[model samples]
Target: MAGQDDERGHDERGQDDERGEGDERGQGASAPATWRRFARERVAQRRFAARQLAELRGYAGRGLVAGTVAVHLVAGLAPVAFMLGTGLALRDLGSDAAIGWLALAAGAFLVQQLVAPVQLVLSRRVQRRVDAACIERLATFSLRGASLAGLERPEVADRLSQADEAFEQWTLTPGAAVEGALALTARYTQLVGSLVVLTWAAGPWAALAGALVAIIARLGQTEAFHRWGDVIRSLAPLRRRANYVRELATGTRAAKEIRTLGLVDWLDDRYVAENRAVLDTLWTRRRAVYGAPFVAYTVAALIGSVIGLLVVARADVDVAAVSVAVQALILCGRFGVIFPESDVKLVYGRGAWQALLELEDIARRTGPEPAAAAPGARLTPQRSVRLDDVRFGYTTDRAVLDGLDLDLPVGTSTALIGVNGAGKTTLVKLLTGMYTPQSGAVRIDGEDLRTLDVDAWQAAFAITFQDYLRYELPLRENVAMAAIAHRDDDEGIRAELERVGLGSLLAELPDGLDTPLTRALPGGRDLSGGQWQRLALARALFAVRHGASVLVLDEPTAQLDARGEAEFYDTFLELTRGVTSLVISHRFSTVRRADRIVVLDGGRVTEAGTHDELVATGGQYARMFDVQARRFADEAGAGSPDEPDDPFDHSAAAGAGATGGAR
Candidate 1:
C-alpha cells in the first residue's frame, strides 16, 4: 500500500512538471467555517486598522487636512446662507433697493464658485495621503517577519489580497465620507439659514415641515444600504468559487498543463458554472435587498416633496422664495442616498482591514528570519556527527527511520546503500537539522543540536538532495548559491564551474557568467537533464570549495550518463579529501570503492563492511549483485565477444567505472 502511494506521488510530480515555476502570486479560497472563525478572531485587527485611519490623519499632521476640513464645512454652509441672503436681497429690491439685491446675489454666487474647486482639490489630496499611509502600514506590518510557508496558506493569501483591495476601498470611502458629511451638513445648514429667512417671509410651521422631510428621507436610505451589505456577505461561497475559477484559468503555473491536457474546455465550463452560481445568488438577493429600499425611498421622497408644496401653497410664497425652498428639499433628498452608501463602504473597508490585521498576527507567530551565513573556515572535523538511537516518522502510522544508530568517523566517506523504502533521504534531513529526531540526538562536537541555533547548525554541512532545486537564475548564481555568502569570490566560483564540466557551457552563453539559465526567462536557454545534473553537482562542489565539512549526496547523480557519473564520483572523492561524507545511492557499482558500505532495510542497518568483504560474505549486497550480473553473463554467452553487438563491454566500465542500474 505504501509503495503504491509512493508511485502515485511520483506520477503526480511528473505530470506537474509541465507547470511554469516562478514567484507565485495569487489568492486561495478558505472553507466556509474557516472564514467564519477568521472573521471572529480578526475583530481586534479590524479595530486596530480602523484606528490607523485616524493615525493616517495624524501623519498628515493636522496642518493641511485639518484646516481643510474646517474650510470645507464653512464652504458647504455658504451656499445655503447665500440662498437665504438672496431672498432677503430680493425683498429689499422689491422695496426699491436694486443695487443691494444685485450685490447680494453676485457675492453669494462668487463665494460658492471659488470655494467649490478649492474644497474639491483639497479633499482629493487628503484621500490620496490617507490611502497611501494605510497601504504602506499594512504591507510593513504583514511582511515584518513572515515565513515562506505562511505565504502559501489559503487564509493568509486571501487576507493579503483583501488588504490590497481594501486600500482602494479606503480611498473611495474617505472621499465619500468627506463629501457625504458635507452633504448632510449642508442640508441642516440650509435649513437653519432658510428657516430664519422664511420666518420673516412665511411662518415657523413651514420651516418645521421642511426639516421633517430631510431627516426622514436620510433614515430610509441608511436602512437600504445596510441590507445590501448583508446580502453580499451571504454570497461569500459563490464569490470564493468564482475567484478560484479565475485563478485556475489565469495562474502561470497552471497554464501550460491546462492547455496541454486539453483541460481548457473543462476549465472554461467550470468557470462559467461558478460564475453563473454567483450571479444567480447575487440576482436573487439583490431584488430582496434593493426592492424594499427602493420602494421606501420613493415613498419618502414623494412625501417630502408633497409637504414642501403644501407649505409653499399655504404661505403663498413668491417665485424666488419657492425656488430656494424647492432646491433645499431636492439637495436633502440626494444626501439620504449618499450617507448610507458611505456607511456600506465603511463596513466592507473595515472587514478587509481586519483581515490584514489577522495576517500580521499570524506572521508574528510563524515567520522565520532569513539567516545570515556566519563566517567559518574550511570545516575540518572538530568532532564526528553522532546518532544515538534516533527515531523519526513523517506521520503517526509509518515510521521511516526508527531507533537508528550510526556514526561516521572523522575524515571518512561512508556509503549508505538501501532498498527503495529504506528512508535514506529522511536520514539525510535528520542529520542536517532540517528535521529533529523523535527519540534520540544528532549531535556535533558534544553540543546538543537543538541547543545550537538552527541557522548555525545547518551551516555545518552542504548537501545535494535527490530532489535538487532547478533555480531559474543566471548560470553563475545557480552554481554560486551553494556558497551565497562568497559574493565576491569570482575566482573560486569559476574554478568550481570548470571542475563540474560546466565551464564550456558557461563560455557558450551569450553573456557568459551573467546569462540566465532558464527558458522561462528572456535571453535564456534551458539545459538538458544531464547538463542540469552537472550544474547541480557544481553547486554542491561550490559548497565543498567554500569549506563544507560534511557532504550528504542523496541519489545525486541519478540523471548523469555513464562517463558523467564516473567523472562526478571521481571529482567528489577528490573534493572531499579532508572532510567527512555520507553518500546514499541505489547504484551499487558506485559504492564498491567506498571505505565502508552500510546496507539499510526497513530503517535498520542489516549489513556493514568493506565492499570486498561484503561480496565474500555473499549477503544482501552480494545476492543483489549476482541477480544483476547473472543477466549480463547469460547475454555475454549468447553473443560473440569480438563483435560490435557484444553484450558485455567491460572495457567501457574499466574506462569510466561500471555504470548501470542497482535498483
Candidate 2:
C-alpha cells in the first residue's frame, strides 16, 4: 500500500511538470510580442535623448559646440599618444631616436595637462548659454496660452515643478547635459584609441576580448543609471511636496503664521517626515539599482586585467611592447568606470530636458484656439459690452456662473453689487478676456468676443481689482506701468496721482516720482494701506488718460475710511464721466452714486435699475440694503456720542441718507 502511495505521488509530480511546460508553450506567442514592445520603448528613449542633445547643442551655438568638441577630442587622444611615444622611447633606448621619442612623450603629457583646463572653460561657457536659453524657452512655453485656464491645470504645475528642479544645485540642467555629452564623447573616443593601441601591442583576439569586457561593463552601469533615473522621476511629486513643506517652514511669506500659530514644531516635523520618506525610498532604490553593477563590474575588471597581463607576459614581446600593452589596458579600464560628469549628469539632465519637452507639447495642445479675427483688429466698443447666457466654472462639478446675462452700456457707470461668491469677479474676468465662458458669448459692440483680438480688447480697459498689485518700483513706474507708452510722461503721472488725491504723498516722497515704493530698496518708502489704494487708483486713472476707454473698479475703496471712501467716490464719478465704468462693491453707500446698480445672485443678474428704483422695488437689493442700514444704525447707536465717529465705520448716516436718495 505504501509503495502504491509513493508511486501515485511520483505520477502527480510528473503531471505537474508537464502542466508547467504546457503553460510555457501556451504563452510562447506573447514572448515575441513582449520583446517587440521593449525594443520600441528602447528606440523611443534613445530618440528622445538624441533630441535633447540636439537642443543643447543648438542652445550652445555651433561655434562654441565645435570648439568644445575639438578640445575634448584632443584631450581624449593625449593619453594614447603619451603611451605610444613612451613605448617608442623605450624601444629606441641608447639610440639617437630615443631623445626624439622622449620629446614626443613630453609633448603629449603637456597636451593632456593643458587640454583639461581649456575644456573646462569651454564647457562653462556652453553651460551659461544653455541655462539662459532654457530659462527663456520655459517662460515662452509657460505663457503660450492666452487664457489662464491652461496654466492652472495641476499637470502643468507639476511639469513646471520638474523643469524648475533641473536648475537646482547638483541637479542636471540643460547646460550640464551639453557639457556631459561633450565629456561622454571624449570618454568614448579615448576608449576607441585605447582599443586600437591594445590591438597593435597584443593581438586582435586579445583586443576583442578586452573590448567585449569593456562594453559589457559599460552596459551594466548604463542600465543601473537608467533605473536610478526612473526612481528619481517616480519620486518627483513626493519631492515637490517635500520642497513645499520646506519652503513653508523657511520662507518669509509664512514666517509670521508659523511663529504666531506655534506651528514651527509642527511644520518642522511634517517637513522632516516628508524628506525622510523621500531619502528612505531613494536609498533603498539606489542600493538595489547600483549594487549588482558595482560588484559585477569590479570582479569583471579584475579578471579582465589579470587575463590581459598574462597574455602580454606569455607573448614574445619586448619590454616596450609590454609597457604599451599595460598602459592601453589601464586606459581601457576607464571605459568601464562611472564618470559623474558624463554618465550621471547626462542621464539625469536628459530626464529634465524630456520633461520640458513634454510640458511644451502639453502647452501647445491645450493652448487657446487661433484668433478668429485678424491680429491687428482692435475692439473699440461703440454700443456696449454684453454677456449673453454665459456659463463658466473653475471645475466641472459645479458652475460659478450659470446662464448669466448682463450688459454694460457704453459711456455709463454700472455698479455690480453682490454677496461673496456671487460670481462678481468671474464676470469681470470674462469681460477682460482673462477667461472664456464655457458656453454662451461675450459681445463687444455686437461682435462675438471670441472673434475679436483678446489683447486689443483687454488693452481698452483700465481696471483696479480689490487685490491690486503694489509694485515695488519707482512711483513713476508704479503708475505708468498701466500704460507703458506713457512711462516717459512724468507730468501725466503726477497729474493722475493728484486726481487720485496722492499729490501730497508724492511731494512727501524723498525722490518724488523717482522714489521706490518699498523699503527694501535704497531711499525707498513704504505707504499706508490708504496710500496704496490711492496709488492703485492713480494707475487706473493713468491708463484712462492714455486711451483706455473703460474703467472697472472692484472694491476699489476697501482700504479707505468711510469719509475717504465717500470723498473718493464723488471724485471718481466726476473723473470717470463719459468713460464706460463698471464698479463692483459690497458698500451700498458708495455704489449708490452710480447711474445703474445691478445685483448679482445665483450667477445671474437678479436686480437691475437705479439704486433708488431697486430700493423702492422691495426685492433682494432692497432687503440687503435695509439689512446693512439697520446694522450700521445699531453700531452708531451703541457708540458713545462723546467719542467721535470711527473713521473706518460703515456710517449709519450714509446708509440712512442713501435709502432716501439724499446724495
Candidate 3:
C-alpha cells in the first residue's frame, strides 16, 4: 500500500507540474553585500530575507524588476538630455552645429515618448509575477508542516496579516515609486550638466550657491520621512479597522447572516466610524511628515531666487550668459523639489522593504514546508489506529482532553457519542492525525501518526464532518472532488449524486450536470441546507466507493427529517458494509446500530458496549436513550399516534418465508 501510494503521489506531482501549480522561487538578492550590515544583531534576519527573496526571484524570474528599472532610467534620461542639448544649442544660436544638436535632441525626446508605453506594460507583468510568487509561497509553507493550532495563535494571526497583502503593495505602488526615484536621479543629472554648462558660461560661485540650496532642501525631506515611518506604524490599528469594515461588507460568508439579521445599519455605521478613523490617522500623520518640509521648501526657494539675482547683477556676465544662468536656475529650483521628494520616497521604500523582509522571515521559519518530518519516517501505518495516554489542551489553563487511551480495530464499525465540548471532535482530529497529542501517541496501524507521511496517511480516509464544505461548483464536480482520481469520470460523479437522492434535483436544473450550484454566479442557483448536506455526504461516499477503506460519517443526517434521517442511517451502514467505520452522532437511534458504541464524557470513555447491552446496564447510554425515546413518544402521542411495528411478527413471517412454509 505504501509503494502504491508513492506511485500515486508521483503521478500527482507530474500532474501539478503540467498544471503549473507549485510554488515559484522568490526574487531577492543573495550577494554577501546584500545580507551584510553594520548592525550585527540584524545579520541573521537579513540573511534570511536575502535567501527568501532569492528563492522568490528564481520562480518569478530575474528580468522584471531590473529590466523595468533599466528601461525607466533610459526613458527618464532621454527627455533631460534633450532639454540640456536644446539649452546648449540656444547658447550657440548662429552656428550650423547648433541646428544639428537641436535635431538630435528632438529625436532623443521622441524615442523617450515611444519607450514609455512599452515600459509600462512590462512593469505591470513583473508586478503580477511578484504577487503570484508571494501567494504560492504562503500556500506551500502554510500546508507543509504548520499545524492548524499554530494558525489559531494570536501572534500567528498578526504575522499572517502582516505578510498577507503587505508584499502586494511593493508590486502595486512601490515599483512605480522606485521608478520615480530613478526619474528624480535623471533630473538631477540633467540639472548638474546644465549647471556645468552655465558655470562655463558665467562664474563658478553662482553654481556653488544653487547646489547648496538643493542639497539642504533634499536633506531636510529625508529627516521628515523618518518621522513619517514611525507615525504610519503607530496608525496600524485604524488601517486594520478600515480593512475589516471592507471585509465585513464584501465577504460572502458574512453577507448571508448579516442581511438575514438586518445588520445593515450597524455594519454601515461601523464602516463609517472606521473610515473616519482612517482619515483622521492619515490627516495627522501627513501633517506631521509634510508640515516642516513645506516651511523648509518655501524658505529655500526664496534663498535660491536671491542667489540667482546676485549672480545676474554682476557686470562681468553677458546677456547670453545671464539667459543660460536663468535656465540653470529654473532647472535647479525644480531639482530642489524633485530631489527632496525622491529622498522621502527612498525612505518609504526602505521601510516597506524592511517590513517585507520581516514578514518573509516569519513565513520561512513557520512556513508549510519545514524539513520533511524526521528522516526514515515514511508515514505508513500498519496496525489499527490507537491513542495512548494522550493529553491535550486548547489553551494553557484549560485542558480539553486528558490521558485518554483507545485502540480502534481495523475493518470494524465503532460509534462515538458525547455531549457538546466533550472532546468528541478533538478525538476525531487526533485519530485522523490533524493535531498531535501534547504528551502521548496517536498511532496508525502500529506506526506513530506523527512520524507517518502526513499527506499520504490522510489521503487514506473519506470523512464527512458536520461542517463540510458546500462548494459553489456543479453538483458533479462537488462529489467528484472527493475522489481526485475520479474527478473527470462523468458517469461515476453522477452515480454518486444519484445515490444521495440528488438525481431528480440534478435533472430538474437548467443545464442538468453543468449547472453551477451558487447564487453568486450567473445562471447559478442555491440549494437548501439539507440539500447541501446530502451533497456533502455524496462527496464522502464517492471517496469510499473508490479506494478509501476508512470512512468517517460525522453527524451525516444532522439536517434530515426524521424519516430521512432513518433512511440515511440505513444507507450509510450499507455503504460502509465491509469497511472500517467510525461514526459520531448525538442521536442514539442512529448510533445504536453500530457494531460497537463508545460513550465519551469529559474526554474519557464512560462506557463501551453494543446498544442492547448498554441499555440493559442502565448507565449513561441508557439515560440518554430514554430521554430521546420519551421525547419521540410524547411527540407521537400528543397528536396523531405513529404507526408501531410488530417486531416478532415480522421476524416470524421472514423465518416462515425462508423455510418455504407458513406455520
Candidate 4:
C-alpha cells in the first residue's frame, strides 16, 4: 500500500510538471521579468471594461441607460443628503432656523430610504437585459472562427477559461460594471460634499486628509485583492485535480470501475488530502494578504479620529460645525474601507473580464477575417482531399501526427484503423478542417485549403465522433442539428432516420419525431447505446441530404456490442452510398468490408488496400486483423457470416458444451 502511494505521488509530481510547463515557459526567459506585464494587464483590464460598456450601450439602448442612471442619480445623493441635514441641524442649533434645519434633515433621510428601493428595482431590470446580451456576445465571439484550432492554443484556452469564470462569478458582466460605475459616482459625489463641509468647518488640511485617506485605502484594497486572485489562479490545477478525484468516487460512470478495482479507499483518501491541501493553502494565503490591510485600516481609522478631535478642540471652529465635520469624516471612512467578501468578488471578476478581452484580441490578431469571403465561399473537393506532410502536436514535446500524408479521393469510403495514440482522430480532425496542420497543406481539388473559407469548408462534411454528445432535445431537432442550414426538413429527417435503421427506435419513442432525448426533461426518454448510434448516423445522413459531400464516422461503434456493430456495418454502407465517407474504427470486423483499409502507425500511413488485398499482403493490417479475429473465433465461434449470435458472447459456447456432454 505504501509502495502504491509512493508510485501515485511520483506520478502526480510528473503530471504537475507537465501541466505547469505552459506557465513556466513564459517565466523561464529572462529570470521572471513581471513589472511590464502587470502594467500591461492593468491597461488591458481598463480596455475590457470599456468594451463591456460599449456592449452594454448596444444591448440596453440609450434610453434604458439614461433612465437607469437618472434613478441612480437620485439614489447616489444619499451621502450628500445626510451631510446637508446634519450640517443644517447643527449650525442653526437654537432658533426657528434650527427647526427648519431639523425638518430638512428628516426630509433628506426619508428621500434616501424611498429612492434606494426604486434604484434597486430599476437596476435589476437593466441588469437582466445587459447580462443576457453580454453572455450572448461572448458565446458569439467564441464561435467566430468555426475551427477547433483556436481551442488548441494554450493562450486561447486560458482566455476561454477566464471568460467562463467571469460569467459564472459575475465579476465582469456589463450589468455589474454599470452598477459599479453608478456606485462609484455616488460615493465620489458624497466625498465632494464631505470635503466642502470639512474645509468650511476646519481648513484645507482636514478636507485634503479625507480625500487622501480614501484614495490610499481604495488603492491598497485593490492591490491586496489582486494578490489574492493570483494565489487562487496558481492553485487552479490543484482544484481541478481534486474535483477529478471527487468525480471518480461519486460519479455514476465510475461506479463499476470503483467496485471492480477496489479504488474507493484510495479515491476517498486522495479526495480528503486534496481538499485539506486546498483549505490549508487558502487560509495561509488569506492570512498573508489580509494581515497588512487590517493594520492599515486600523491606523487610518485612528488617525481620522484624532484629526476630528483636534478640529473639535479648535476655538475658531464652532462646536456645531465641528460636529458636522466629524460626521463627514466618519462617512469617508465607511466609503473608503473595502469588505473582503464582496470587494474580492469584484477583483476576480475584473481579472476574468480582462482575460476574455485579451483572448478576443489574440484571436482577432491571429485569425483575421480574409478579404476574399473565405468564410462564405465553398471549395468542393471533387477530385480529392490531401494532407501533404502534415505535422501537429498538443504540446511541444510530443507530436501526435508528424509529417503524415494521406489522400481521400471523392466518392470513396476509406476505413482508417490504428491503435490508440496512432493519430486516427487527429487525421480526421485535420481532414474535416477542424484543425490546420503546422507544416502541411490540406488541399482540396488541388487548391490550398487555407485559401477557402474555413466555415464554408466545414459545411462540406458530416461527422459523428465516438464520444458523440446526447443533447437533451427533441428527436427531430437532434437529427436536424446536422443540417442546421435546412433544419425545417421534417420529411428529410424521417427519411434519413429510416435509412440509418432508426425506424423501429422512433416508433418506440412516445412522441415520434418530437420525443425528447434525455430523462432529465419532462416527457423525455433516453435510448440504448445502439439506438443512439443509429440516431447519430441519421444526423450525418441528414447533413448529406442537405448538401454535405462527405461523411466521417470516427470509431462510432466503440461503445456497441458485437451484434450491434455487425448490424451497423450492414446498414452503414447502404445509408452512405456515393457520399465520400471515412470510417475510423479499431475493430477489424466492419473495417474488412470497406472499399479500402488504410493502416496508420507512428503518425503515418503504413499500408492501404482492400481487406482481401491487405490480408493477402500479410502486412501490418493483416497482423492486426488476425489477432482480433482469433479472439472471436476461439471463444464463441460466432464471427463468420453464417453465425447468427454475438461473436464476443460466450453463451453459445457454454450451450454447445452442455449439449455435447448430454449426448
Best candidate per TM-score, number? 2
Model 2, global lDDT: 0.79
Estimate, for each residue in 596-628, the C-alpha lDDT of model 1 and write its tens digit. Answer: 888887776778899889989999988766654
Q: Any idea what lDDT model 4 has?
A: 0.69
lDDT (Cα, 0-100) at 236 in candidate 1: 55
- CA lDDT, every model vs. true structure: 0.65, 0.79, 0.65, 0.69
Clashing residue pair totals per candidate (backbone < 3 A): 0, 0, 19, 2
Preferred candidate (TM-score higher): 3 or 4: 4
List model 2 lDDT by residue over 293-384, tens digit each: 67887688778877877887787878898889888777776667788778878877777776676555555455464343443344678999
Weakest 10 consecutive residues of candidate 1 by summed lDDT = 18-27
- Give me candidate 4's TM-score against the actual structure: 0.81
> Tell me, what's the RMSD of every candidate?
11.8, 9.8, 11.4, 9.0
Score candidate 1 by lDDT.
0.65
User: Candidate 2 regions off by >4 Å?
Assistant: 1-40, 144-146, 167-171, 297-306, 367-378, 640-663
Residue by residue across 1-663, what tens digits does model 4's lDDT show?
Answer: 112233334446546654555465666734343444445455554454455455545566677777767766665566566666677677777778878877777777888889777767766666667667767767866775424666556676665666675677664554565555544545566677787877777787777776666655665666676678778766655666676688778766688888899988888888999998888999999998888775786577568656655654663777677777787777666655764323644555545544555556556555434323343344467888888999987767888888888888888899988777888888888786667777788898877777777677777888999888777899988999887766678889889888767778778888888889888778899988877887887888888887788889987766655555656676677767888889887766667667888888888888999988998999887777666655555554543455535433323321121101000
Point out the higher-scoring one by lDDT: 3 or 4: 4
Error of 3 at 200 (Å): 5.7
- Pick the lDDT winner: 2
- Write one digit per residue (lDDT tens) for candidate 3, span 1-663: 112233334436545543432222133434453323212323433343334334434443666656765776676567556765676677678999789878878988888888778776765565456556555655665676466666555545554554554555553223333433444545565666766765765678777766766666654554455457657655555666688888989888799889999999999999999998878878977886788766877687669767865875672866656766776666666654535424544444434433444444444443233345442233333458778888887876877788887767777789988778888889888787667688788878767666666766666788999899888887678887778668777887788788878888888889877788998888888898888888888888888777777788887777765555655665666778777789887776667778899888776778898989998999988787767665545544564554333111222111111101000
Assess the local accuracy of residue 228 in candidate 1 as a C-alpha lDDT between 0 and 100: 62
